[model samples]
Target: MSASHTHGDCCDHQDRHQFSLRKALIPIAVSALLFVIGLLFNKALNNTPYSVGEYAVLIPAYLISGWSVLITAGRNILRGRIFDENFLMAIATLGAIAIHELPEAVAVMLFFQIGELFQDYSVGRSRRSIKALLEVRPDTANLKLGDQVREVDPKSINIGDLILIRPGEKVPLDGEILSGQSQVDTSALTGESVPRTVVTGETVLSGMINQSGVLTVRVTKPFAESSISRILELVENASSKKANTEKFITRFARYYTPVVVVLSLAVAILPPLLIAGATQAEWTYRALVLLVISCPCGLVISIPLGYFGGVGGAAKRGILVKGSVFLDALAQVKTVVFDKTGTLTQGNFRVTDVISENGFTQSQLLALAAQVESQSNHPVAQSIRQAHGKSVHKSGVQEYEEIAGHGIIARIEERTVLAGNDRLLHRESIPHDVCIVEGTVTHLAVDGEYTGRIVIEDELKEDAIAAIQALHLQGIQTVMLTGDNQAVADRIAHTLGLDQYRAELLPEGKVAALEEILDRASHTQGKVAFVGDGINDAPVIARADVGMAMGGLGSDAAIETADVVIMTDAPSKVAEAIAIAQRTLQIVWQNIILAMTVKAIFIGLGAVGVATLWEAVFADVGVALLAIFNAGRILR
Candidate 1:
């Protein structure tokens, strides 16, 4: 058994023998004792017993499994905190024993303990998954001392301390690589599936695994202040920030448990003492029946279990649902607003075609374009330089000047070159033909003559169309928002078959669009969700009812602000997130209805004379067991 699993009197479930074989032994021992005693009594005397001894054998089993609860309840009663679950279980079981219902009392406690065990097992499994993501603070790091490697705690490893990372080892601290290159798996931090390649001069984060090559890293951040550690802390404390449903259930149980206890006491005592004129034993038996019916086991436990299961389940699938409130919000999301660049399309720019004019070769036009744009750092400039297929030499370029948002002007071998849109050519009074091409076009001009134009565009994401269709199937309204011009936006939107499209929006414009949708959705039965992947989109992400981040290539600000994070860059995960949320909500409602229905039936039966103490005990524990099992179904 793992040492972490050992707690108080609870058997360590990690132990193979205790969890499996020992549990199997409990029923066998009970059966043996009961059967042997009954046979011996039958053989010795002439009286044929009704197998009553079989029920008596259950006492040892119940005490073995649930004695901790009984002790805890007794301790609470001695103090003043007597209205808890432990107290409820103890009272109900003791009442059943007083009514001469040994089997029922033992069965109820046994079944309840079994449910508790199951919860512990499920919780342990989830804890394992959570721990897998949590990069624990490393106690020691391999710091280079002279020519040899020495072991030192991560805290002791200061800035510029060279830490050697061997194969299959986690990076001890965040720093820039001093030497070597390797594929670092960052699935723990971003929940992404692929490994990221990192080389010298590039930054590497702590808790990432060095897959194959060895690396000598320098420690930049302190051990206590690492990003992975901070994120783990956030995840651990996430449960404390409960949803409205979680708070409601907790409050509901606190009042509901005490009320049921009082009502059960009244049902047991009032009628039998005044109206029936029954004997003390007969009245006490009825009171015990009342206690059994008023257990409240189902409602008290299942609601929180349902939500916990939902959150943990979503986490397993690489979706970081912050809390139950966000999960609930996502289930009812109708309008999904998407940012055009990184959210719906691959934001990377690629050169598509080069349309040359005035008898200029593609190479000559591209070289002139690259020389002028060498002084510029625009995305289009980068795409043009990358597609030129030759290294650019800035020695020939003289007097380079940037024209703000328009373009760039430079002198290459005394030839005036302008590499920008038609706006720059028009502003410079340079004559240019209207050479129309699809997507984004970067015009090139040399000596006031139109040389060529490079077509640079952002491609649509592979699953963009399918993702929108999936949302439509779920009756959700999909909307696209972009800062791109109307013509370009319309081309991408129409290709994706989106329900609605809005183009030419600034950062504030996008926020206004989200607010309008949210206002409209407030009157309806759904929430407004914004999906974006830029720093400027953080305000809109925070303002929306539910914010989804496209991870992998997503910005740190966007991922940090969003409620749900899709680990992959694929937009199709948006639909998957909604589907999972809807499923979780359905499971929660099902558990609530089932628990309430069973409680109502048993409570009504216990109030009258129709049900016995044994039947009431079965109703309480059986319903609780069923509801817990139902909650666990979500994990599967």
Candidate 2:
């Protein structure tokens, strides 16, 4: 009985999870059919007078294509909001019918729905793209209950539950593999194409697809707190935080629509009352034409849609822009500050040279260093351990103390092991040999005597130099802030041609350094963007005008807090995102210019009684269609 109940619950949940997108396209199909029939009726009545049959046919066509708009106008009227597009289109077409222009009224509503259909399509396309990007959500988990493996909803599983994942199945929840080995594809979250190899005791995140092996994983996090769930939450709330341009357009439409309504009213009443030659019928016709031009649907619809397209295009390239505000800020950035380790460089250290003093074997020095360094996970320390090539048990080490940004101090069986920078040796009053090296040097002192210096280096990313050059080409300055020594920082700065460098800084120091760069950029009213691999740089990323996180191997704090997440851990995406923002802005301004110029000309002619209803329709509906298509160019 319990098994059947759970199975039924799963089936019901699966039905709800699947959305019928075809249902949304039904209205579009109906509107298109009515549009075609309306056109046919208009062509048939061009040379003939319409009777009751024609009125009956045209009225239904208008209602079939525009019932939703009519209902929305009525509802908004009851709510005391009457100057929106629905009201404008409804009033204009109803007035045409009152003037006995039956065919024109149907045509107006048909064309209006055509424009509306495109608007719906644009909005739907954007929403669908975001949904598809988040398609990583797993529907069911293979729950392992003793010897039985049963299917269950992911939400029904809890922490510490054992789950089995087969080949090509998504990891249902964040967990650690209890057994088995396989390669898991994490491209859904990180945007990297390469599948990561995993074995027993390795933790795997939700939304990753397992390939080539069966595995048992112990759930570590619930479904609500998973990675894909958080991404969905971010996207769902993104639109509430509008861009500056979107807000301006919202306020503009609030006044622009009502004012134009009053203008149309004045054109209808005042001209007939003040001018002797003007008749009521002629001026009222002109008033109807003026009403059609009053709606700024072209500008209002296209601008936001253009920004959405830009964001969708960026998503396709593995960049997640949380909102248009960040996209707007990205366009105006004059300076970009970068975190050094794990950002500009690979963050993987390799020992270049091991200098030994006083006839001590190099192997003895490395073994001593690894014994102490194995206690820490610092990148340089790991490099030393890797170079040592032999594992040193940590049980023999005693009294370990870590000095921030400098080095470490430990005792290996009564032999004091100091493995760190020059500052660490100086602080301990240990006389150490000064070794001039191009790469980072970790000084090692044994029993307060200078032994040798080990040189470790983190090579620059393959695209770091090119990324800096591209930013320079765009007239943007670049700065690097790291906790490395001055020598290492200067070497990287010179090689990358950066404008400035701040070395040997703590996390707080990085934030302070960012403030200095931001203050300098204030003179130009420009923004500053800080890009990092996203773990230790969260504070600086939060303080910048735009926080761009390299998200291929991202941390949750950075991915959630940063406004922009570059999916691939490549610096080049930073420059590419800026280009997309600039291009979006360019298209927005073009739509503004195109819509305003055409509307001004048509409205001027409309006010003078020279423009016909046909001209008015084209000025309103045709311009909207053109601007929407123009906005589509952002994706290209």
Q: Assess each prediction's global lDDT (C-alpha) against the native.
A: 0.72, 0.80
Model 1: per-residue lDDT, tens digit, 386-414? Answer: 88868889898898888753678888898
TM-score of each: 0.77, 0.86
Residue-by-residue lDDT tens digits, candidate 2, 53-96:
55656777778766766886787688777677778778988999
On the 0 to 100 scale, the lDDT of residue 510 in model 1 is 81
Query: Which segments of model 1 are wrong by more than 4 Å?
Result: 1-63, 74-80, 98-100, 135-163, 173-207, 216-227, 351-437, 440-455, 552-554
Q: Best-fitting candidate, measured by TM-score?
A: 2
In candidate 2, stretches whose alpha carbon ends up further than 4 angstroms from where it belongs are: 1-50, 144-148, 156-162, 175-183, 190-203, 215-221, 352-377, 381-404, 407-419, 426-430, 444-454
Extract clashing residue pairs from model 1.
Answer: none
- The alpha-carbon RMSD values of the candidates against the true structure, listed in the order shown, are 6.7, 6.8
